[model samples]
Target chain A: MEHLPSEQSAAVRRIVAQHKERPGPLVEVLHAIQASFGYVPEGAVPVVAEELNLSRAEVHGVVTFYHYFRHTRPGAHTVSLCQAESCQSMGAEKLAEHARRRLGIDFHQTTADGRFSLEPIYCLGNCACSPAALIDGELHGRLTPEGFDELVAAKAKPAT
Target chain B: MTTTVYVPGDAGALSVGAGEVAAAISAEAKRRGVALDLVRNGSRGAYWLEPFVEVQTARERVAYGPVRAKDVPSLFAADFLKGGTHPLSLGLTDSIPWLRSQQRLTFERVGVIDPRSVADYVKHGGYRGLERALQLSGADIVQAVTASGLRGRGGAAFPTGIKWKTVLDQSAPQKYVTCNADEGDSGTFADRMLMEGDPLSLIEGMTIAGIAVGATQGYIYLRAEYPHAHAALKAAIAAAYQARYLGADVAGSGRRFDLEVRLGAGAYICGEETSMLESLEGKRGEVRVRPPLPAIKGLFGRPTIVNNVVTLTSVPWILAHGAEAYANYGMGKSRGTLPIQLAGNIRRGGLVERAFGLTLRELLYDIGGGTATGRPIRAVQIGGPLGAYVPPAHFDTALDYEALAAVGAMLGHGGLVVFDDTVDMARMARYAMEFCAIESCGKCTPCRIGSTRGVEVIDRILAGVDGERNVQLLEELCETMVQGSLCGLGGMAPFPVQSALKHFREDFRARV
Candidate 1:
């Protein structure tokens, strides 16, 4: 009875069509939807379910299960801090606290200015250089509180 | 001759300013009018020396590292292009003691070759295994793997050959070979390194598995946390398809095998094989019961061969070389080499691929160069978040599966995370439960509910509110999770907590 924005609906249909022939293609479809929109909009779920011949609950269950899927619109830049044991061994907890205070937002929260969003990642597979973080998909290792501030500040400045 | 330079595009290297170093070298070399060819290679598994740049000389590759962007001009002035001496130069990279002593079998071409080049991978003995497999029957291939004694490198230590044999024996219309590239374990990067370094080997390995198990379609369940690995795998897979190494008629064998890489969002439990298969099916990452194991009924109700990236990658070597060649290395039943990832608070943290007989002390001190802080080595959490906290007393124990298991520790994926004297045992113990609680897949009662209670018990013990009793309760809860949980996630999550209680009882007492 309801519909998404025409453009988003078309994109979702295109993604589902590409993967519909493959066995168990719903996850791949969801991944494509998220990649296009940065987050799976609430409007995209029902469209995906209908196109993929799955229930709405089935679609929503998967979206909520994994921590990586974003439900809300992210800020200009997304920052993910590794909160696993390896990072914790090298003071990742303190680093996380520092980032929270610096960004003025806790994990899973966006800044008021919409410049940054923070999330806690399990691992980035760069444990050799512990206390790692990903700012807009670029990983930074051996992250200290000071280095993190410098990185955030550097990114905040407007490009020439 | 154009001077060839290598700056690792390995994510670990890129993370610590290697990208900036590469840019500086490019700009500086252009200004100096030096003709240079820059090849973005993978890390040599030496974290301490990264942005470890190498220059090709007639003798060997000359290494200079921990190189910063500012150091690029000085490196150029010092005639590093000609392998001239510099303060940072380690001269003849292979001669470095850290990398020289280890046996790098699975990681043979990791830092040496261009990851996306099929020709480079082939020149370095890449598809020889698939070549050998095409000439043999599926039964014979399974027999060879079984004879090699190759076990699962995904922490389960299940016999890989037996898993393949099950899939081979099963009568299915559509069997599949699924590589568990979901390397979500903390303090482990061997899978990432291999994927980013020599992805062709993994592709070859999967092809061989498909040939053995009669599987035409394969899927690589890669974790999304490693966007760098994802990019490398995607590019390499395209190259493999172009070269006729992946799609139908692989290597002109007429036996079809198509491989695809599916990304897992951010679930840690999906590292488990059944959970991985469940996630692959577009479901919540809930663990399936194992009456009809994944070997029999997996991946869309067909027989499946689910293996770790290392295990499948190890297959090419086992097939290329004789089973005896692989079986000859290591101690006892744990045959072949393991890519041991030394991480966390270690001075020379990197990957050390060696036979399984090396002791924890040798790894921590000799290879790892002890704690990065130069303080006393207090504890080392072997495996990952699900592994045990090995004390200094057990440092003499061998790293083989049986040997480590004897000491109540499992060599789960060969990730050893070191800790210095400043570590808080109680807090570390609390974190183990907290991590379990956070990541538990909520299918069974013991795992989903027990983890939450275990955290509360640890908090109560730490608060000294009837500390001894709460500690006992924590132990009881750990036992329940171990015996009652459906999968290894809950079953082994209490290992660190139990080990902490067993060895660092004094720390808990002090906290109380």
Candidate 2:
């Protein structure tokens, strides 16, 4: 088992404590931990399991089950392209291919520079303007290959 | 006098650059020294015309849209703030032909008012249903819902009233009302729009459910994908709390109803009611076997009322107006209006809330204006990924529940994803199985294993490897999944594949 730093362990305990009173607080606690940390740290799983009085396997099973919860550190920005039927009708498959070629990475892969991570989201409820992509939680619809490139380029620039 | 300009804060509108357009309008107004009162309202469901801007004139709100940030300068020059003419102008928002044709019951105030304002919600006849529900006894409230002919809008088509009646009849000290806001259906956005546009309606509806079922607590099991909706719901909930429409003393009725939103972690299976309950309990989103329905033992083993966002949201309208009024709108078994979503390859794709008798021909061509790519529309997939695909022959099928079922289709959540001739039916079939394989919870065998096998069989057929035998094997596998799976996820996943095979047989021919 990986050992979490004392500070990280304390943060996990605090996150668990904040939501412990609520019924079925494990998911909420995990969300809080992931929000504070980029991903659910493996080392913190045992701590959460201890605080919630659940087994480590149970905690680990939950963390792995949900697609939203990441296991590794994410890049500076995450790009989620809609891959469902509506988006597919609007050429999302082609757009996905273009995204992969542009990012030089497939879905669920991060760029070597750690600038962007690409994910295939089932739907974002923005189907009216299909072939939608969420760039750092901001949605862009009717996205052409060029639009995708521009979005990536904008994110790539360093902050002033 | 300051001119009031309406800009949609709806997620659909924002996706098409409404946020940037609003900023441009603000900046342009300041530059021209024009006094402007910009209100961020919800989308009118005319997504083709979004970011659909409206200006309040003496007579009505004039519309202009598909507006870009660059068009802001030209709009200002034309004095669009005063309902001035512009190339993008669509005249009066109310009189727009596409929107004017439909019947909007649940979405009455969606694109009209600021979603965050409880006062605006009240002004538009929001809490009247809750007020009515407050006056009635629990059994009376249940009877009213039963009389309304309201079915579950979450694709189950279960009687909303019966579910409530069961929960009402249960003798439990702690019960709950759980709103399934996990709208994971690919082509659907009605739930999202309602949540973002008029969240107070949902909040009010849930409160009514709580009072009706003796459930003081409520939880909206919202999906994590909709960050916009999450923010909107949270803000609206806080406002409801402040106005005393929520907390222990809801609307001074001396009843307790507390509501909060819980985020689901991107599990499509969680959209399933039992799976959702499991996920809410901080576990893997595995399907729970029926016989003990969620209505009997749901959400922490309590006799719970589990309803869809639209179903719960519609409770206010039913309570506000008589049940007969709602019942009179739609056709035989399926009653009342459904918020239909037009998406995919369609030219004028958006939300259309209408009574259930409208045919697909009216939706696809008359309203949607045909395919966006100018190609012939080959097929239309209604009711999410699990729904059957209808070829052009069955385009005349009505949007009613039984009407669709008669033609081997179902109006699951009222989403229509149109596809043009360019679509490869073979690939789509494979994708259906693939989607099922990915989203299926491993608890069930036919769903978990059958889906993967179905995908492989389709792949082989596509690759020209014993195509005939592979197709047969795929059909058998789909049958097994349909008959054997514990829940809808596995059970209905084969509908699209079977429909595709039944309709477009030539697509499955050997590639070589």
Candidate 3:
């Protein structure tokens, strides 16, 4: 799958229009753009900076300050496992190693088939269950290798 | 008269399936053909015992918790149908040691009252600060805050009273009050908890600030990830407005204050006051330069009062009980309670609010009961990502903001992430820079590009590069990010990255 959906540009334009009135709304604008595009594409930065009356550097700085904003397109399926203290207590380190080995990709990179991307989530507030992962946006808790593989299998399986 | 049984409806409880818990109770009540009084209450901040259920009887509320929907059938069978004690029952909810131990000045009514009911907030000593604040001069209000010694709880422990004094003293016609609720710190969730459990407290806090600082409008820049909190806050704000607790001429006290909730696009950097202001104005969350502090020129280039959720939440307590009562809580110059988020490998993980003097050892062993894994804790990171990695050797150190700083660390946010024996300090140190690289606003060179290259340097060091040179290069890079970066995103990002490397040199050497 392409990192960004084909109509990503249209989404960026729509977000910029919604937040044009407020002063210094560059970050909000970028977030919407990124939401529409998955990552904040290099192409959208100039337009956002221009619309918000901010220098390009200033716009770029805000984007970089936050870890949530991705600059590249995610693979078809993205799995962010929590590594915060609580999640780690639940063996997130071991889980992360399992994920990396299975997917054959480190934190920020995509898999060869473009079927999945795995990343470390600092925390997703599922600490009580521990070893939580967000399969896309859904929270999955008490994860084992089998549970992870089951979820991965669904994402990996071809749709009819 | 409406009979109501309060159950904590905070997001944490909800995350652990509070919806199902609520459904079970309602279903049990209905099946037995019993008239019921159920009220979803805010979090009491006692997270360990969640889905904390309480039943309203003629006299007092009986509590039971750590409940599930599956347990409902058993509860029904046991005739807990009449608010009687069961195996899960913990007697009176207020008497629980964990609940009673907390200095719940801000969280006073959270887990006890109906969140959507405006009357509940008012009845529980809500808006009393705004009522009192309206009668005082702006300077007097600011002075009272200064007297309270309340510091910003969003990690930067700058005195909040001082910030208010500056903004109050500034002569600007247009000012904005911004609540930094974009709580992206991994191990911390106080902001989200406050918003979900007792949003009125935050609204009251912001309104009080508006009255004190001469601002009419406020915005809560909330993180997008907390959809439940956003819904709760939005509903609470609407209730406040309907009851005249917010909007123009609130409570007819002749003081005008209005607030709106703005969803942050999941950017951690926006937690910084300036970046928060930027995001609120509907832009990409970015750091702005100082000298033109938010007090004088912020949010549309107008003077602004930007405060963390905790700092402002304490306002009502300061005003109601007087600043001296609050100021008397803490040990040193850091004179106020801090809600330290205990997380990571810990058996007990939740918020612990106390005066600023508890040692890390006490927090770890006494409060936390050591690691959840039951292994010896090797290292602990106090504060969020940017915090220093503290070894057990510094176990005697106090939890004061200044004390932490004295030992080459700063308490950014009170997120203590513990790591056990199996952890690798070198790998942890490298991940910090990698996190910085991924999240660095790229505003400054040291953080933007430096973080990416910092990872490379760490890799080289790990792959048998000249150890001494690699260490020196890492140190030099940290200094640049510290001096050159615009905000805490880069300024403090090196603390965890560098401190782990500094204190755990053997770990890094072992990798090589």
Q: How does each model score on TM-score?
A: 0.98, 0.99, 0.87
Off by over 4 Å in 2: none
- Per-candidate RMSD, Å: 1.4, 0.8, 4.0
Chain B alone, TM-score of each model?
Answer: 0.99, 0.99, 0.95
Q: Which candidate has the top score in TM-score?
A: 2
- Provide the overall lDDT of each model, using Cα atoms, as 2-decimal numbers: 0.92, 0.93, 0.78
Predicted structure with the largest lDDT when compared to the true one = 2
Cα lDDT tens digits for candidate 1, A57-157: 99988888988889888999999999987898899999999999999999999999999999999989999999899999999999999999999999899
Clashes of each: 0, 0, 19
Please give the distance, in angstroms, between residue B345's alpha carbon in candidate 3 and its true position after superposition: 1.0
Predicted candidate 1 versus true structure: per-residue lDDT over B324-344, tens digit per residue: 999999889999999999999
DockQ (C-alpha based) per candidate is: 0.84, 0.88, 0.33
Per-residue CA lDDT of candidate 2, range B95-190, in tens?
999999989989999999999999999999999999999899999999999999999999989999999999888888799999999999999999
Q: Model 3 shows how many backbone clashes? A: 19
Question: Which digits, one per residue and each the tens of the lDDT, describe model 3 over residues A1-160?
Answer: 1233436656666788897776555666776776666788876766666666678787776676556778788899988887765576568888999999888899988998888888777666555456778777666656787778888988888998
Which pairs clash (backbone N, Cα, C closer than 3 Å) in model 1?
A: none
